[model samples]
Target chain A: MKIHNFNAGPSVLPKEVVKKSAQSIINFNGSGLSLLEISHRSIDFLEIIEKATFLIKRIMNLNDDYAILFLQGGATLQFSMVPYNLMNQEASYLDTGFWAHNAIKEAKKFGKVKVLFSGKNKNYTYISTNYHIPCDMDYFHCTSNNTIVGTQMKIFPRTSIPIVCDMSSDIFSRKLDFCQFGLIYASAQKNVSSAGMTIVIVKKNILGTIRKNIPSYMDYKIHIQNNSILNTPNVFSIYTSMLTLKWIENQGGLSFLEKNNQKKAKLLYDEIDQNNLFENKIHQENRSNMNVTFFLKEKNLEKEFNKMWKKENIVGLDGHRYLGGYRASIYNALPLESVQFLIEIMKEFERKFS
Target chain B: MKIHNFNAGPSVLPKEVVKKSAQSIINFNGSGLSLLEISHRSIDFLEIIEKATFLIKRIMNLNDDYAILFLQGGATLQFSMVPYNLMNQEASYLDTGFWAHNAIKEAKKFGKVKVLFSGKNKNYTYISTNYHIPCDMDYFHCTSNNTIVGTQMKIFPRTSIPIVCDMSSDIFSRKLDFCQFGLIYASAQKNVSSAGMTIVIVKKNILGTIRKNIPSYMDYKIHIQNNSILNTPNVFSIYTSMLTLKWIENQGGLSFLEKNNQKKAKLLYDEIDQNNLFENKIHQENRSNMNVTFFLKEKNLEKEFNKMWKKENIVGLDGHRYLGGYRASIYNALPLESVQFLIEIMKEFERKFS
Candidate 1:
């Protein structure tokens, strides 16, 4: 059975990346050693990390001032690390959904945190654009994409305070002006690599101002100065990410990904609107191209809809625990053909019920 | 060439484990989804994590009182997490080697750390057993095996003050009384899985006593309550570890491993003793069965020795950067034939030079 994977974060990966990574696990670069067993300090691994770092800088159009780090723990760790390293007195945060709220929660432990905007009252179905960016804030934080609610920030708010964005789901899936943000972090499972690594791109000049004695692993200055090899890193995750980036680069980088992403989102969103049986919860303007969420208009049809998708070998189409319905996370690796197939199923589902 | 891998941590994995892991990466258990692409929340992954947890307890003879957590960020993060979670005001640490020194350095940020003994003066050739355990201290920390200097603690000191040990290098290689320690942590790269994962075994009752607000990801109590699914874990690393543990369980568990480990260590140590070309660095009683450190009697023979080993397809025989000597890390995965092959090469080099 051809499985259509759509689980949010730790989601689908490029087929080529999967194949190459598997081969490397058996024998890494013909070195007669499993990728799972090779030293991170070896020449082969050093090249892999260097290439992965270089590709991120090149694809994102980031300059030399930015340092690319492949660290362990997901975006959750970054929630504390961002505040621990950057926030000395106060920080501003935009709470869009679950992950953003968690980030805000972590930041509160470090120093004072001011919430600029929150979409929680609206069930996170929309993005908030009308909010004041506090000038006195140490940094402004926001999640670029809300995975659970299926809302995405279409345009980043212009702020004088150094901007820190958690682009976990949307990174490398769109074109953006990289210079505007001082620090950007993304967990690898979404559009990048496997589930264990987090990629941090930080502007070097913004660090070291804080007086707190940061833990060595969480310290950005130490990781940057040591070239991300301060300790034995998650080598498999980093190497898998390198293969994923190679795929992204080959497919014309973010520009190509953005176009395909738009096409996929439109195919599914247009069907949801046309069909009477289904309705998207998120506002059209704020709809995420990565995670397209919708629910059946008739609640009783949920069981039948789930059975139909499962029969078709579709995985991870169910919604999150907090929000019940359906969330089809169409990451960069998910093909347009799969999206079209899903649309066909949706239309058939509506025809039988309506 | 069939390469003889002897790299320290992120070292050799059992052939069966590597093969199975690679297959899983392609299509996990006929699910038509790559292990890399499967959601961590899926039933497939949850079962894997549960089984891995269960086996660790069963093999280590740990009860429900101990919390087994498979976390990300290697042992480097544990150096801080150990103190951040357990230490209230003061802790005692044994300065065994490079990693031990690093642990002490990270502990200083959390509390007043007292060094009971340091092996630095003796080039970390021996573990200190002469120190008294401070009654007032919160915990006593030590490294069971030093990879760099090739020393292993023959017997752990009987300490009442919550004993904390970093068993990264020699974990699961032999049978030991697992109940003697309050907390035990090991980096997965050594005798476990890949580099990005860490295994933490802590006593459940000891936590929540510290009033300090530990960052959620670093807090053991929260992680335990959440069943180590606090965030998106390194799925690949965890899965790989499970496969390795399965292999260990299949091979008659730790008792079988202990005999094989001793045999490999004795074979290499015998060669080093008999051959005048090479000399073992550590004291005879303190030598690590996991990592055997040695030096060439004549420094000029280093280049020839390197060439000879390279020709035989031996990898990771080079010493750590800080110390210039050879370190043969024969982990559980390495077959006895590979060590014998290395010994053959060592004898040949001596014959050619002598």
Candidate 2:
């Protein structure tokens, strides 16, 4: 039976990409050598990284002003790197979820990080409406979508300050004005590729502005100068991302993926709101299409609900450790049928108990 | 036709490791899910990482005083991280090769870096045998094997200060007194895994000595606390390393592999010394078993030699761009038959041209 995978990060990937990646691992381009064994400087791999960088830029409609780099370490590394390279004296960040809070924490180490707004008061059930961005700050940082709590920032704050967004969870799944941000980074595990590499798209002008001497690996300017080959990169992850980004391009780019994601999210969320046994706690407008958080109305029936999903082969539905409900992450690779199957389980539980 | 592969670092892996790794990528232990899709926090990955850490410590005969960690950004990142975490007022470094010079360069940014010795006068053809490591320095750093010019430090200096070794190119290829070092790091691409992940073995007591505020990712103490999962690690690279390490264990551990490596090195080095067309420039005692760098005695025969190797379906024969000739990297995974094949080509070229 096909497992209805909902696990966030290192999560579902396109089947075609997985198959092709496996084939490459065994015999890369019929070279009689596994991709794992080839040199990154080899023409085969050089073409891969080049195409990966090219695909992402074209897929996102990014212009020549941007530099696309695939670097090791996840988005967490970028938390420190962003501030190390760009933060001069002060920066602004929104505390939306667990990861966003971490970005704020790491940034504070380099300089002052002003929390523009936080959703912590209501158990992170909504995104803040009113916020102020100090223009004097070096940059404004925000999480585009909160994976842990299933909240997203739909309307970005309009300001002259360079907006640095952490789009780890919802990048490439929706259409947005990417030009509005100075820097954007996403851990490939979420929606891009595997779990080893992070993709960064940065405006060239925003780099090298900090006075502090940045470590070479964390310095964006150095990486851009080296064309992202400053060191040995995560070859598998970058190749996987290239395959995935090509898949997106084939499916008509972000606009089509965004529409498919919406369809899946609506099917799951509608069942959560209408079913008597379930409750969708996150505010309707701020709810994330990438991750849908729902809970059992009656706490005592948790065991029954769990049994139903297990029998239906639903996986990764358990919420984050910090949040103990259920979260169905409907990422770009998750098919609509999986969401439909999950709704069937939710409906059956409602009928049996309600 | 079987290719006699000899590319250094990201060169070749055990065939079994590549096969199993590729299978896991597709189905992942019959879980009906690709390994690329499973969460890093899942039980499967957690077990893989734990076993990997255990195997390395046992293989190296490390006591509880050592901490094993798998990190990203390769050994180049370690160039900066070592100084960031351990350097106090000053440290000593030996400049042996292209990479060693880079390590010294990065360390200078953190504190005063004293050059204990250098091989620059000989075109990095030999390791400096005499070096005074001051006890006052926080640590003495050296490269165990220089991949660029095929020089290996057969003997290390005795010192009271912490000894840090960058064993990137020749880790686990020979038996050594691993307990003598304060820290040992190897980028997995060379002798361990695919790429992106670097293996770090550090003595526990040496940490927390630097009073500087280290970045979380760069700090060894933080990675130790997190059990090498400080962030989403290079899952593919880690998994591949685990398989290769397991292969090493099944082949009777490092002692057996060390003897086999010596046999292969002796066979090839003897042929190089006897062959009239080729030259081995590195000092005899400093010649590396892992990477054998050779040059054409008669420069005009370079075209014939290149043609001969290409005809045999051999790849990755070119040496580092800085040193133009050939570098045959005979890692543990490379069969002795490949060496024999390469020797056959050299003998044929000499018979034809000389």
Candidate 3:
């Protein structure tokens, strides 16, 4: 039975990508060596990373000004690395949700950090778009999507200072203007690849401006110079990412993915709004297309709602630990039929209850 | 046609480990989700990491004083992290080979570094155990095995100060007393599993003494607090490592592996000694049982030697780019039969030449 997986991260991968990844584990491109066993510097792996870099840049519509890197340490590492490399004295951050809060905390450890705007006061249901950017700061940072609250920034705040974004949850899900951001990083669990690797797209000229002598592993300039092969990378994750990218390209790139994602979100959100039993706290314009969070109106119906979903073969619909509600994360790999299936279950439960 | 793999790191894995890992990639223990597609916080992955942590400590004969962590960003990350978290004023390092040199370079960026001993002047043909370690230094660091030069420390140099070892290449190839080192870190590609994940074993008390506000990702204390679940780790690598660890245990643990590894090393070393066509560089006492590096007596036979090995379905024998020769890394999973096959080919080639 194919479970309709809606995991937020390390989440659903395309069936074809999973099949090919499994095959590569046994034998990578018929090299008589498992992809897991080969040297990262081998011709096969070098080509794999090269193609992955190309695909990421092409998908993002980025140019030579940006250097594409596949790194380990995930986005959590980037929390500190961003400040360690970019912040000279002070930086401004938009505190959106859980991950963005972490980015702010880590930045403060290195130097002065100014929280220009915060959604915490309102439970992070809405995006803070009308934020005042401090021109004196080295860079402005924000989380593109709040995974826990299912709120996303549809329009980025323009700032004279270099802009940084932690697009961990919604990086390749939509058309992103590459020119606006100085640095963009995303952990490859949600929409890109698997867990453990982070894709960093940075404008090359933005690095080396900080006077602090940064550690090589965390330094963007060093990684760019080495082409992200500073050490033996997470080869499996990068290769898996390559397969995912290939899958996305085959599905007709960002435009098609964006449309599909929006359609899925509309179907689920519309059901939640019309049905009295369910409630979506997020504002309609701010609701994430990738992660759609909802709760039961009566609160007592939570258990029965969960059982119904389980019976329908739904997985990862349980909300985050901090938030006790249901969240359906419909990433690029999630098919429209799965969303439709979830909608049908919701409507059936509503009808039965009424 | 399974080629005999001998790559130094990211090398051969046990047949069972590979099979089980491939299966998990498709469906993790019948969870209806690929291992690559599950959240790190999921119970399934949590259990996998717990088992892996337990097995590593148990295999090493470590007590609760030690903390075992599975992290992303390979041993290369450890180069800077060690100094950032451990070194306060000054540190000492043994100059062994390529990786050790890199470690020293990274450490200097944080504090004063002193080279306690250097094997470089002699082309790393011997391990230096006679050198004096400075007790006043913050910590003394060394590489347990020189992968490129095929030299292993038969006995570690005792130091009163904290002792850290980069055991990337020869971690589980033999049995050893684990009490001597304050910290032991190894990239999984060598003996543990695949690339992209690093295993760190540290004495819990050694942390918080430095007083530096270490980055969360680099801080051993933080990782220990989080049980190495501080961020999204390389899930695929850790799971695969757990499978390999189980395979190691089923093969009768480290004692059996030590005996098997020694026997394989002796078989090949004896051939190199007896056969006048090839010459081994390192002294007998310092010779590594994990990686056996050698060269042709005439150097002109290199092309023919490579071709002969290729015809026999032998792989990863090519030396490091910096060093031009051959390195056969017979990690724990490599069978005695493979070593015997390699010896047979060496003899046949010798006979043909004679």
Candidate 4:
């Protein structure tokens, strides 16, 4: 069966990336050793880490001021780590979705987290922009894309405070202004590659500000000093992410990915808007270009629609458990054909139901 | 060129485990979806988590009273979490090696950590047997295997205090009595798969004892309550580890691994002892079956010997930067043939050097 995955995360990856990653695990770079079994400190494995970091900078057009690091734990860990490292006195946050809320919760542990804006009133259906960025705050935190509610901050709010983004779902989908932010992090399973690595890009000058005695692993300065080799890293995950970055480069980098992403998102959203049987709840301006969420006119028809999609070998279309409906996450690696096929299925369903 | 990897960790993994893990990353279990691209909350991924936990329990013969958790942040993070959760007033530590020192450092932040015994006087050359484990301490902490110094505790010290172990390097290499310890954690890169996930086995009753308001991610109680899915986990690392565990099962379980490990370690150690050109520094009784550290008989020949080994495609044999010499790590997945080949090369080197 030809399955088209619509999973929000640990989500779709490039076929080439998958094939190459599989081969590398068996005999990485023809070393005749499994990628899983090599020391992270070995020259070969160091090359993997170096290449992964180098490519992130290359693809993102990040300057030397930015240091790219591959850390474990996940964006969730970063939720706490960010505050532990950066949030000394106060931090500003925009509560965009579940992830943002979690980040806020962690930040509160360090100091006062001023929630400048939140979409909680709309049940997290849209991005809240009515906010005042406090100058006194150390940094402004936001989730660039909401994976669950399917909304995104299309344009980042202007803030003098260092911008810290949890771009778990939307990183690499489009070109990012590395200069505008002090730090940016994303879990690899979404747009990068797999679930075992978290990519952290931090500006060099931001270290040593935290007054607390941060644990060595969580401390960005320690990781930076050691060159992200403080401990044995997820070698296979890093290698696979490197492969994904190479694939991205081959596909013409971020500019190319943005076009494809926009096209895929537009196709799905256009179908939902044009068809009377289906409707997208998120305002079009705030709708995520990555996760397109919608529901049929008859809410009870969700089960039938989900079953139909599954039969068509379309998986992971079900919305988050907290939010019932369908969410199709079109990350960078997800091909346009998969989105087109999904649209065809939606069209067929619309014709049948109408 | 064929490479012989003796990395401490991200160490060697079974070739079969690597191949299977790589395949799953592209199209998991014939689902036609990349494992990297799937949701951690998806039923498919949930099954991976469940099966991974179940397999660990079954293979280890763990009782139902212990909860096996797949956590992020590696064992370093666990150092803080363990003390945070278990230390009410004070804790006792056996300072055996680098890891033990790190654990104690983290524990100090939480509360008073009483050092029961330390090998620091001898530069951590041997595990200490003479120590008074304080009954007043909340728990006694120790590292089961020391990767850097190449030493293992021949017997766990008898103590009234609850035992907590960092079994990072030697987990799954032998059978363990789970009931003896309150908690045992191994970062999955060594004997399991990669370094993104930490396997934590904690007693259920130990929860809620700590006085501090632990961060949700750092709290064992919350992770246990949520079944280690407190947030999106390192899905790919866990899934690969599951494959490795399955491979272990196929290879006649822990007993088979133990026997193979002993045989492999003995071959290299015998070669080191009988040959005048090479010598192992640790006391034979305290030698680690996992990491076998050695040095050249003639100090001047060390660099030449390392270069010679590299030319033979035997990589990662160089000792840790802090401990200059050579360390051949014979992890579980390391083939007997690789060890035999290393012995052959060693014999050749000895004949030439002698």
Candidate 5:
């Protein structure tokens, strides 16, 4: 049976990407050496990173003002990096869920972080647009999508201050105006690429304002100056990301992916509302298109329902440890058929048990 | 011609490791999901990491006092993290080569750094072991191997302070007591795995001493507590490292590889010493077994020598830009035949030119 992968981040990637990356590992571009063996500064890898950064800007419609950096340490490192590079006086943050709060926790170590709003009052069930952005703050920080609670910001707060976003979960799966944010960082384990690399797209002017001796690894300016080759980078990760970006571009960019994602989300969320056996707790409008989280109405059905999905060859359908519900992360590469297949299983479970 | 890869690193991995890792990228352990697509928290990956860590301790014979952490951001990140976590007031460092100097530079930012001795007076051609490490310092930092100038420290200075060594190039290629150092960090692209992952084997007690709110990513204690899954790690790189380590064990562990490495080094260095057209400036005792550096007696022969090697399908023979000549990085995976193959090409070139 073919496995239907609904894993969260480091989740499903394109089949073609899988095949191509696999081939490269054995003999990279007919170089007679494995991709694991070539120098990062080689002409082959230099072109790969260069093309990968070029594709990121082209797909996102980002201008030259934005410096694209392929960094390591995941988005967790960015929680500290964002404040270290931008927060001189203080920064304002909107705590959406676990990761956003994690970012806030790290930002506190660097300087003052005023949480403009938090979703904790309601079990983080909805994305609040009610928070007012303080104009005097250094930067307005927020997570574009919260994977844990399945809440996504439908609209970002308008502010004169530069907007910094951690879009680790739902970056390439949606469309947004490119100029609305000053900084954006996403872990490659999501819809972007394999694990081990982080993409940091920042407007060049917003950096160098903070009065701190930021370490070279944390400094945005240093990475930009070095073209992300300040040190030995994750060459294989960057190459894998390049293949993924090429796949995304070939499928007609964000406009096409946005439509594909919306269709998938609609199919899964509709099944949740119609099926009495399963219930979704997240607010309807704030529901994430990338991840659909729903729980079985009768908690005792957990074993049977899990067995049903496993027997049907579905994997990674379990929700995050933070929330005790089922989550199907329909990323950019997750086929619409996977969602349809999952719905069929949900219906089958209802037919037998309900 | 079959290429003989001599790239410093992201250098050659074992052929078996390359093939197996490539297969995993397509269908990880017959799970029908690409290794790149699986969650780091999944049972398969957790087992992979657990086994990888277990094998590391077994191969090195390190006791429970050491915590083996699979991290990202390479050795450069460790430059900052080592000081951020261990250097309470000050640290003493031996300035040996480019990367060693980089560690000292980053350490100076975190705490007072005293460079006990620098090889820059003689152009980093030798490793100096005569430097006095201050016992008052929190740690004494040094690099076990220098890939840039091709020098290796055959003996580590005995110090009362914690010894933190950056063994990026020659780790796992030789056997050592391992208990002599408080911390040892190595980039996986060298004698370990692919790029994007760093192996940090640190003593458990030496950490938690620095009086600072260390960032989660930088804190060794946090990583140990979380079992190196503190955040989303480079799952692919870790898996590849596991494969490489397993390959090492199957090759009769470090003792066998040490003999193999010495044989390769002996063959190449003997050829370099005997060749009338070539010369090596490094102190004989400090020469690296991992990377052997040699220069042409006639600088005008550069083009002809480059042509000869390229024609023979020898890649990455070019030396570091900092100190230009030639470098043959005979890492653990590089076969004795490849080194012999390089010697044949060198003799062929000499027959035509010398």
Candidate 6:
């Protein structure tokens, strides 16, 4: 049975990326050594670092001004690190969803964090409209996409303050403006390869601004100086991400990926809107092009529907424990056919129950 | 040509471990998703965590009194964390080499670190003697293996106080008296799998004694409370380590691994000792069975010998930049055949250059 994966964040990956990564693990470049066992400082492994870094720049249109680092500890760590590094005085944060709320909580420990706006009043079902970027704040922080609620900031708010983004869920799904942000970090799981490596793209000028005594691993300046080999990196995960970047490039870069993502989201969203038995909760204008969340006409049918989907090998459809319905995360690498098949399944369910 | 990997830390791994790990990354146990891309909270992944934790206890012969944790940020992070969690007052340390020194430095940031003894008088060429552990110290800290200097503590020092060991290089390479040590940690690159995961074996009772407001990530109590899933862990590395653990079990457990390691080390050490062309600098009694550091008889011939070894596909023989010469790290995955091959190459070099 060909199962369709719709896992949110540590989600689906391209088949070629998985195959290439697997081969490298067994025998990397005919060296008769597992990638898992090669030193990160070795010339062979350093080449991987170089190639991965180069591909990241080429794909994202980043320049020499920005340094790419592969660090451990997920985006959750970065939420604190971003504030620890950049927030000496105050930082303006837009609270959109659960992740943003968590980021704000971490930032508060470092210094004063000015809440520019929040969507919590609507139960985080929408992105906030009001914006008040604090002039004295060190940086304005925001999550590019809200994974839990299926809402994305289609266009970023204009701000003069140095911008730092926690793009953990929506990093490579679309082309990002690299020059605008001082620092951008993404936990590599969604749209990237796996769960282990966190990619930090930082502007070289913004390295040593933190006032407090920063730990070597947490400090961007130390990492830039050491070339991300300050310690033994997550080697296998970084290598797999390199393979994924290659796959993304082969699929015609972000421009092509954006179109594919739009198509996948459209197929599922259209089905949800047209069917009387289904309803997508998010406002249509701000709906995520990656994750499409919908619910059955009656809450009673939810458990049975989830069970049927599980039997059919349609995995990860049961929504987050907090959301409590259904969500199909159609990230990059989820083929259009998979989404179509899911829509067909929905139609079959509607016919049987509607 | 098959290469002999002698890279310190991320050195070599069994072919079977790599193959199995690669398979899991592509589709873990018929889950139809890459192990690299799965939520840590997923039932499949939870089983992976449970099994890995269980197997560590089985392999180490640990009793129920110890709690095992898989953490991020490497041994360097643990250098600071150990003290942050345990060093409420004074801590005793044996300054053996670079790693021990780094640990002392981090510990100094929190409280007074009493240097019980140091091999710095001999440039850390040997393990310390004439140790005096302070009774008032909270705990005694020591690094079991020094990767850079190629020296190891043959036996752990007996102590009334709690003992903490950074067993990064020689962990699982030999039999460990788990009951003697209060806590033992190893960054997974050396003898386990790849980098990114740090395995901490902590005695259950010693956790709550520390009186400090440690950050959530740095706090051992929080990790113990959350079952090491305080946040999303390095899932792929943990999964790979599980594969390595299973491989270790299959090869007749730790006893078999100890014997195999001893045999491999003896082969290389014999060649170094018998041949006039090579000389191991460390004190023989304190010499590491893992990293065998040696230099050529003629300084000029070192370059020629390195080139010759490279031609034989022996990679990562070049020692740490801080400690010049060559280092052959014969970790568990390094077959005895590779050591014999290296010996043959050395003899050939001796015939031509000696």
Clash count of each predicted structure: 0, 0, 1, 8, 2, 0
lDDT of 2 at B187: 95
Q: Name every residue pair that clashes in candidate 3.
A: B10-B189
Residue-level error in angstroms, candidate 2, position B155: 1.4
The sequence of per-residue lDDT tens digits that candidate 2 reaches over residues B136-194 is 99999999999989999899989998999999988999899999999999999988998
In the range B1-354, model 1's lDDT, one tens digit per residue, is 688998987899998888999999999999889999888888999999999999999999999999999998888899999999989999999999999999999999998999999988988888768899888999999999998989999899897788899999999999999999999999999899988889999988778889998899999998998988898998988998899888999999999999999999999999999998999978788889999989999999899999989888898999998998899999999999999999999999989996
Chain B TM-scores per candidate, in order, are: 0.99, 0.99, 0.98, 0.98, 0.99, 0.98
**What is the TM-score of chain A, computed separately for every candidate?**
0.99, 0.99, 0.98, 0.98, 0.99, 0.98
lDDT string, candidate 5, A1-354, tens digits: 588999997899999988999999988898788888899999999999989989999999988999999999999999999988998888999988999999999999988989999988898898778878879999999998898888899898889999999999998888899789999999999898899999999999998887787888989999999999999898888998899999999999999999999999999999999998999999988999988899988999999999999988899999999888899999999998999999999998889999
Error of 6 at B6 (Å): 1.5
Query: TM-score, each model?
Result: 0.99, 0.98, 0.98, 0.96, 0.99, 0.96
In terms of TM-score, how similar is model 4 to the real structure? 0.96
Task: Quote the lDDT for B110 in model 6.
Answer: 80
Worst 10 residues of 6 chain B by lDDT: B210-219
Interface RMSD of each: 0.9, 1.1, 1.0, 1.8, 0.9, 1.6
Per-residue lDDT over B158-225 for candidate 5, one digit per residue giving the tens place of the 0 to 100 score: 88888999999999999898999999999999898889999999999888877799888988999999
For model 6, residues B46-143, the per-residue Cα lDDT tens digits are 88889999999999899889999999889988888788788888999999998899888878878898998889889788876678786778999999
- Candidate 4 per-residue C-alpha lDDT over B1-354 given as tens digits, one digit per residue, 9 for 90 to 100: 567888888887777777778778667788777677777887887898899989988998887889999997788889998987888999999899998999999889888989988898897888768787868889999999999999987788777777999999999998767678889999988899777789999888877767776767888988998998887788878888889989999999999998999999999999999999889988888899999999887899877777777888887888888888899999998889889999988888888878
lDDT for B226 (candidate 1)? 90
What CAPRI-style quality would you assign to candidate 2? medium
**What is candidate 3's CA lDDT for residue A100?**
90
lDDT of 3 by residue, B29-134 (tens): 8888898888888889899999998999888899999999998888889999999889999999999888898899999999999998888888988877788887
What does DockQ give for each predicted structure?
0.85, 0.77, 0.78, 0.69, 0.84, 0.64
Q: Write the per-residue lDDT of candidate 4 for residues A179-255, one digit (tens) a residue.
A: 88889999888888777689999998977787897877778998999898777777777888888889899999999
lDDT at residue B36 of model 6 (Cα atoms): 73
